[model samples]
Target: MSIKSTAARAFAAYVDRQTKRWSRRPIKSQHKVFQNLLKVAGNTAFAKAHSFNTIKTHKDFVNQVPVRDYEDLKPYIDRVVAGESDILWPGKPLYFAKTSGTTSGAKYIPLTKDSMPEHIKAARNAILSYIYETGNSNFVDGKMIFLQGSPVLEEQNGIQLGRLSGIVAHYVPDYLQRNRMPSWETNCIEDWETKVEAVIDETLPENMSVISGIPSWLQMYFERIVARTGKKVGEVFPDLSLLIYGGVNFEPYKAKFDALIGRKIDSIELFPASEGFFAYQDKQSEKGMLLLLDAGIFYEFIPADQFHEENPPRLTIGDVEIGVNYVMIISTTAGLWAYNIGDTIAFTSTKPYRVVVTGRIKHYISASGEHVIGKEVEEAMRVTVEKHGFIINEFTVAPQLETPAGELPYHEWFIEMDQRPDEQKIKEFTAALDQEMRQQNSYYDDLIKGKVLQPLKLRVLETGAFQQYMKSIGKLGGQNKLPRLSNDRKIAGFFENI
Candidate 1:
């Protein structure tokens, strides 16, 4: 390793040690530490600049502060945008991580100098854990690739200085800087359309080993890599040991990825948003686990059953139970207190706190008076595909309420298959999907008996097609993801050309 890498690795080692030490604490003690961190960082009037020394206990913080969301904090963010230094976290607030949600409207989330370390630390832990699980740490000896957003910070005038991906690119270790593109830094080359093309050309180099990005974007890149290099992913990047991905679910995209690589590539999932690096997959087979970073945030959960309950209990990490679905609420060093991130999760177990992302609390379809969740749809789709002996490359389901001529309410599946199957096969597949839905949800069964629910409508796409559409639209990147369901009548219009 070069001198800078040596120094960086040393810092990494120290952080890893600290994290392992923290991870060893008894469950309650770890939760206490998490709570204390929040109390120190969450003072309402004084939270703009936190003093870590003042916070002592969870009780002190919980009682003093009420749960808050971005709507509640908008005024503070506005003041910061107006160049008020003290409204947000103290020190120079460099820029906000842009995010949008139902309640937040549009958020320009504040990021401090301190944000990168937490982000990097959680990432490193994820890497180390994957390495340990797969026994492939040595595969990282070659050029490390990151497919991220350009680091260009946005200005008020609608001109962007640099892409966020570029910002992350510039901060790469000095040793790796020589191995990367200097052209990646110049903001003058603001043409992202051309930059992406050039990056695709450069990525065809022989030495790159680890590749990371959102699944959709990475799939596009993999297509480019194969086309340019005339080699499969495994042949071109023989040293590739890990495929790190985040920002969306990987289940539907798994078959497409395996086909590109010509085999299974070890993969890890990152559950990060602009707010902070929330969690990362710690093991290969474990989808998305909560690798809790106590140093950064305090976590709370509201039971799914009690989500609409008045005065519902907001249970801390200490109070979490296995197999329960809960809405994740966070208190972060970045000054979000008991903020509902609007994501729901089901804990597989609590001994080590494994969570499967259930769905967006706000993003669901209720049709014919029965609510359908994202996870339920995903599971039903999984069953459908398995029964058909085929795999779903990508899919979205929209609920169309039909007063079935003489039957019950049903669903319409807008499926993007990796390859086409026969009409008979499609019928069998939809029947299996309906069976899975009936088994999982009693409401669907009741609706079917009442002839209020209709049978599922299957709309299949041509192979390798939707991807090309997304590419043509210039949305093949880290933050952009395929919409899972298009409920509007425009869905037909959108797919009519396909």
Candidate 2:
């Protein structure tokens, strides 16, 4: 074996040892993490106000610190943005990862020196864990093209602001830097289309063995590469073996990606967000991501069904049960205290704790008592995509509440298709999709059976409609996703006029 491969294997072994040690006693490790976070930031204004010093146990911490969404903590974040220190974390954050969701406007999430390493560590371990599990170390010896956001960070109130990917780009390790593609200047190009083209120009001829990004953006990159090279991804990068993806469900894009790459490749899924790097695919044989129990973040889960309740039952890592969807609440080293990250997830394993991101809490459809989440919608679409033998490039679902006086409300899907199917096939596709939705969601099934809700509807969008919509919202690419399901007609109405 080459020296580079041997070094890679050694690093992977170290990470594997740490991961195994942490996984052996998840609850104990997590408790220590929470206590450490509390001890470190106990003197901060937010922590003191919440009586962090007086908190002795997990229950005490839970009772003292109420679960909060971004809006609830915005006042303190605003102070931080205005040059305040010790408001949240101990001192001013090193940077803020700017993120936006379906319901909220721009949100600035703090990333301090204490918290940034969690992101770095989680990312490194994701790859290293993959290597350790699969015995694939040659990937490190070749180039890795991370199709992330621009590296050029914007300064605001003396704090750096950018996408999490952009911030991470600045911190690529020295060893990996030699094998990472796309020059800093190329990455700094703000326009995603321009940057992607430049990236293709730079990495197409390199010895690329790994590619990582949000699936949709990576799909775009793959399409451009295919168009430019007149060859499949396998031919272009013969050494390519691993595809790292996050931010969206990979199942929906799997078929298209398989076709683009010309072969099935190993993949790793991650649950990284602006708040913290939470989970990653640890074992190839494992179904869901193993929760990063030892990461410097304390986790709480509120049952999804009870998420709207005044005081939902908050569950710690020890209490979380498999198969129950829960909204994740996190208390991070960055000083976020029991903050709801808005994503819903369900545990698939309990011994070591593994979870699959189910959906977004805001990104759900329940206009007529049939609550449909991103997971259900994606599953329905996946079924439809499989049955129809066509690909949905982009899609969103919203309630059609303002139907004609006699008509029942229904869910409407706005789909951007790679190849438009005929009207007959579209009708069959919608029926199959509606059936899948009914199978997945009992509430929706009952609503359909009771004749209270009409069957789901689909409207094929114009070729570039989704892109136009994304650009209109200034969220065209690089981890920005169209909210799959909306309770209101906001997204549907916008698409209608287009």
Candidate 3:
């Protein structure tokens, strides 16, 4: 059947669940809704589109559905391009949100009518929760700027399109649109490369209330505004109340942001993805709480403890524990069911469901081919920075692999310190970091024996260099997370450009 027919069936199924919840029935009763959708979507075709789909019941769904990584889905995406409507839910995909998957390869993630509400709600919930938690409900007092990607779709007829930033604008809920800054339609037409420059050029009143996005990108925007205006950001917009951001740990970036604004900006963390916004910081100082997207998704968590074994134990939101990082698995109205997106998150409190995204499960390197993780690097960096009594402005790590030519594999460190560190202190700190890495991972022993890589090299640049490099690449925003582990030379190239 056509893509439209399939999407209509899927959307109809999603709507049916809403209809049930509207009648005051528990939303959880819709667990069977998707299975019923599969029948209307047609058994063979639905199974074909959703890999290994021989789903018999909801239990089968919970157990039989093997996890999918973006790499595994690429061929199906290629099939969609070849005009195969079966893989894509039947209908014209309103737009494709171009996103970076696990490999840093671009994925044109579909944003159909069925999926758009989830994105809208996520952004909305993040805003509302921040306002409520901070007790700063002056949303209407001044414009709230979202340093997001351009809203313009790359094409009109074909499925290829812009990022979620664009699609979210196209499908914004009427109620939330009023508080948006820069106007969504204007954002759609603006070139991303010119967005930071344009935002800097636009003159507004001194009472801008809130600004939000990735920390590094926001730093770039603040810097540019200062450069052009001959004044600090606070001088330009003195009424700025909060600086909400996400996608990376804020501690490493706090010094620079505080320095730019001339004050400590209150921050709220967000956990957003192409498919949906999953969590956000509920309080000013606490980590993010998993605000249940009861309206859009069903969540499942795989325990980090069981994650290493061949067979892992998966838990639902109901079974979650405090302080244990788990691999998040979610089923959303958008299309995915029992999908593992590779995010590693830890709950701080179970009563309110507060959690923090600690790292990506597979987004790290190891010494003996054992997987080293993002959290490990983050903890080590946090400890080293604190111990040195110097704040880290920005940083990244890349594993330098050894070749047969008498070289050893070692980690190359790119550190942007808040101030120039003394050489002696730098040496002492590097040694401490090396020791920490060795303690955490077994590969350091091999390196010490000259069996693996060399000792990690620390390359500390001036404070603002990393920010300058990110801006040079047109990534000035709250959405651009700094790449933690640069396996290849891409980050090294970014550093070189600076």
Candidate 4:
């Protein structure tokens, strides 16, 4: 082995030791995080407004600081944007991570110097843990490409503003700078399709060993590569061994990915957001990711069912139960106090605290009393696809409230299938999907038995239905994702029009 490989392995071992120091004491780490956040940020305007100095316990915190979302917290953020120091956190934020999910145009999430390095550290340790476990540090010698947003940033007042991914590009360690791909000029190209084309041209002949990005965006790059080279992606880049993905669940895209790669490659899932890096898959054998309790952020959870109540109980890590879906709340060094990040997650293991992203707070099918989440639908798709060897490109579920004269309303599943089935097969597929849903959700089963709802219906769209929908809305690539199901027909209507 080369000196660099030896050095990398040594560092990975060190990180493993350091991680265990905190991971083994999960509750203690969180307690320290809570105390540190309150103590350091007490002098800030937001802390004072929330009476942080008077808070002693979690109970005190809940009483002093009510949970808030972007719209609720914007008054202080607006001041920070206008060049106010010590408004949120101490001093001005080093950068504002510009994002959008709100009805209110662009969201600017602050990134302080203290919180910024944690992003880099968590990302680095994810890889290090993999390397230490598998003894595969040689990939560090080859090219590593992270298909991300433009690095070019805009200055709002004095704080730099850009997408979180783009802002992260500026902080990559010097050692890996030479191994990172897609030239700066290519990454700066405004359009995603053009950027992918430029990326393909640059890395086609290089020794690429790692590829990372949002799976849907990476799918476009893979298809383009196959079309151009007339070879599978694995054959084109034989050294590629790792596929790293975040943003959306990767299960829906796995069949297409296997077809494109022509082989099995190890994959890692990460749970990160503009607010904070929450978890990363640490073991190849495990089902969920390792939650970060000491990442300069304090986590809280409200039972998903009780989330909309005027006064929902906020539980800390010690109080969370496995398999119970909870809407995640967080307070961080970046100065977001009791902020709801809008994600729903379920704990797979609370021994050391690991969680799986279940769905979005606003993204679910609950037209009736039956509340169907993203995890249930994704699981249903997986089992059905395994039983019947059909390939699905993408799909979403919505309630069909309108019905014909004698028909009962049912769920309408809009799917873009890669392999078309005969009418008999489609009937079987739809029946299987309905059965899975009923098995997973008791309320849905009761509704079916009582005749309040009919069996779910399937509507197969053309091959590129989802791609067309995303492109139509100018969200075709770069960290964009479709929710598995919606309570309304906003997305379903798009497919209906087509």
Candidate 5:
């Protein structure tokens, strides 16, 4: 009966209607999106170089443009940075989302005026879809705290540069800005410890209804708040109804978060990246997010197992099969043609296509030929948590390539513990985890049976080791996460001295 509630209901309904319409015929919608993207950027240098003008259909476009990663497209990006027009998109990008690169220093992904709206739309619709599905619009009357990166942006070649969350922060709609916290000044504090302290000061007493951020950082906030108030998160903010999270899997963090909160709150997962907003949890009953077919991006999927092939088969919405892991490829309004974002996902439903992110292409461990991915590692951790009755605050695994004197090479796990178990318990935990991983990955099982790899080594990290490492790298929060598994010990080495 309240005006605000009525307005929210209307908005949610409209978003639901639009989402249903777009998802009703996913294949056709994707085809139209692809054709439109090509038409919009047909005059750009990238399009011309890739023979976009001659492309009339999705198949034609795929055949013409070869898939490229960030490294392969660096030259064109440099040209764009040097103030070139129509180099990638129609004009220059509004900003660049600066993220860490797998093999090197940094990656600057373009965020164009044409494509930025898609990100905004997807973020808005995520909440609206939740509202529509749950009929819980009462939260609209309360505050929503979004734990994001610093709002302060740096200019590069006349375009802004910052983390994707920071760049997106600049575009927060005026209406929502009233209920969003902390203040812009507090958000600019780069140090995670200092920023979190400032956020607690600003928001501890507010009428908070929703909290949105990467789960790890959000967990940090919850821990800080609980420590200060000597109360559970639910006790501190009883009105809190929803937790929106992305950037990492929530399974490993679920139990820990629930224990901290003292009660269960509804949660929604999102699939967003610097490249584009791809999917959102549209229905409460559905485990996977509904892919945004009508977003200003065209999608292709290459089977993950074959992604390394020179000409691996690329399938579109029409041909992709459910349950098959595929590396996502995109040609977007930002003018990235057949760009591989390095994320691997599998479709859970094909009728109105939905997907769950499987893992990252580069974030895997294959030491001793036992290829272990993020999903497998997270599952192992989940089982370890359940069996040991312990909680892990953060963790990463890397290969110990050099054996100690006369031992076999094995995986080393550096874990930050929420509740440290005794030595015997830790040993039992590692054994259970190793067994679970071997059960999940046949290659790993084979390696263990053949005596080629030793049992996993566990290293307990200091309370804030992961935070300190992230802070040292200037990636303390907002979409940045420690790689779960790495082929090298670069990350493990950082924590060794700490």
Candidate 6:
């Protein structure tokens, strides 16, 4: 083994030892985090408005601070953006992680000096966990690439503002700086297509081992690489061993990734957002991630079923149950208290507090009484594809409330594939998918049986249809995720003309 690999393994051992302390005693760690956040939060303007001085316990916090989304917290965040100190956090945020929003136009999430390291440390340890578990660390010496947004950022009132990935670009550790790709000039390209091309050119001859990005964008990059080199990624970079992905469920895309890579390699899933770093998959053999309880963020849970009610029962890690959907609430050192980041997750292990991100709170189809979520659709597609041998590039579902005269309403799925299914095969594929959906969500099954809804219809999209749609919206790159399913016709309507 190389000297660097030996050193990495040693460090991984040390990290695993330290991580055990908090992971083993998650409830205690969370209580300590809650206390620390409460103590420091008393100085902020949000705290003053919410009666933070009088709060002493979790029950007091629940009464004092109601759950608030970005819109509810915007007033305080607005002041922070205007160079006001002690508005949200104790001082102006070190950086504003600007992200695209569905209802809110643009959201600027704060990252304080205290909270920034949480993001970096979780990401670092995720890789170290892999090294320690598998006893393989030689990939550290090879080239690593993270497909992301431009590193260039804008300034607002002396505070740097950019995509969270771009802000993180500035903080790439010195040890890995020499091994990271593509060149800075290539990464700064404004157009995503051009950037992907440039990135391919820069790394075509290098030893790329670790690749990370949102799965969809990474798919586009991998396709481009194949088009250039006329070889699978595994053949192009024999050393490539690990993939790190987040922002969406990777299930539906796993088949395509496996085909492109031409072999199996390990991958790590991360639950991260502009608001906070939540979890990372610590074991290659496991599905869920280890939730970070002591990472400068205190967490709460609201059962997803009761989330719409006026006073949903709030839960701590101690009260959360396995397989029960819950809306994740966070109080972070970045000064977001009782903040609803909008993602829903379920605990897979309560002992160490491991969770799987299920879906977004707002991004669902409940147009009819049958609520369908991202996780269900993703799993259904995965199962259908595996059983029927039909590979898909990308897909999304939207309700088709308007149908032909006298025809029942049904769900419409826009599917993109490199290889077209024959007419009869298409029929079989759709039927298989419909059956899977019916099995996954009982409400959907009842609707089909009751004749309230028709079986879902499918539309085959041309190659690159989803990518083209993303580009049309000026969100072609950098931390952007295409919605898997929407209640409205926004994405569905766009697919209609195509």
When sorted by TM-score, best at the front, the candidate numbers are 6, 4, 2, 5, 1, 3
Instruction: Go through the candidates in order and give the C-alpha RMSD of each one to the true structure.
Output: 4.2, 1.6, 7.9, 1.0, 1.7, 0.9
Model 4: ten consecutive residues of lowest lDDT: 474-483
Per-residue CA lDDT of candidate 6, range 357-446, in tens?
A: 889889898877888988889889999999998879999999998888999999999999999979999999999999999999999999
The C-alpha lDDT values of all candidates are 0.66, 0.88, 0.65, 0.91, 0.88, 0.91
Report the CA-based lDDT of candidate 3 relative to the real structure: 0.65
TM-score of 1: 0.84
Which ten contiguous residues of candidate 2 have the minimum total lDDT? Answer: 98-107
Q: What range of 10 consecutive residues in model 3 has the weakest lDDT sum?
A: 19-28
Which model, 2 or 3, shows the larger lDDT? Answer: 2
Using all chains and alpha carbons, the TM-scores for the candidates as numbered come to 0.84, 0.96, 0.78, 0.98, 0.96, 0.99
- Inter-residue clash pairs, candidate 6: none
User: What does candidate 1's lDDT look like per residue over 1-498, in tens digits?
Assistant: 545444545554565566566566536555665655544445344463334345556555555555666887677667766666544454435556665344545576666666656776677778766655554555545666676666656675332233345455546756455544424543234443455566666665646767887887677777677877788888887777778888777776776788788877777888876667877887666545764746466677888667777667888766787767788887666666667877788877565666788777665666575666677777776666656667677777776654446654457777776567888988888888888887766777777777777667788888666666566655545366666654444444456576
Off by over 4 Å in 2: 101-105
**Residue-wise lDDT of candidate 5 within 346-414, one digit each (tens)?**
899986899988899988998677878888888889987887778788899999978778889999999
lDDT of 2 by residue, 308-380 (tens): 9888899888888899989999999887889998899999898778999989998888888888889888888
Candidate with more favorable, higher TM-score: 3 or 5 = 5
Candidate 2 global Cα RMSD: 1.6
The Cα error of candidate 3 at residue 267, in Å, is: 2.0
Candidate 6 displacement at residue 407 in angstroms: 0.9
Q: Is candidate 2 or candidate 4 better by lDDT?
A: 4
* Residue-level error in angstroms, candidate 6, position 329: 0.7
Question: Model 1's lDDT to the true fold?
Answer: 0.66
Model 4 per-residue lDDT tens digits across residues 287-317: 8899999999999999999999999999999
Q: Write candidate 3's Cα lDDT for 189-208 as tens digits.
A: 45544767666555354357
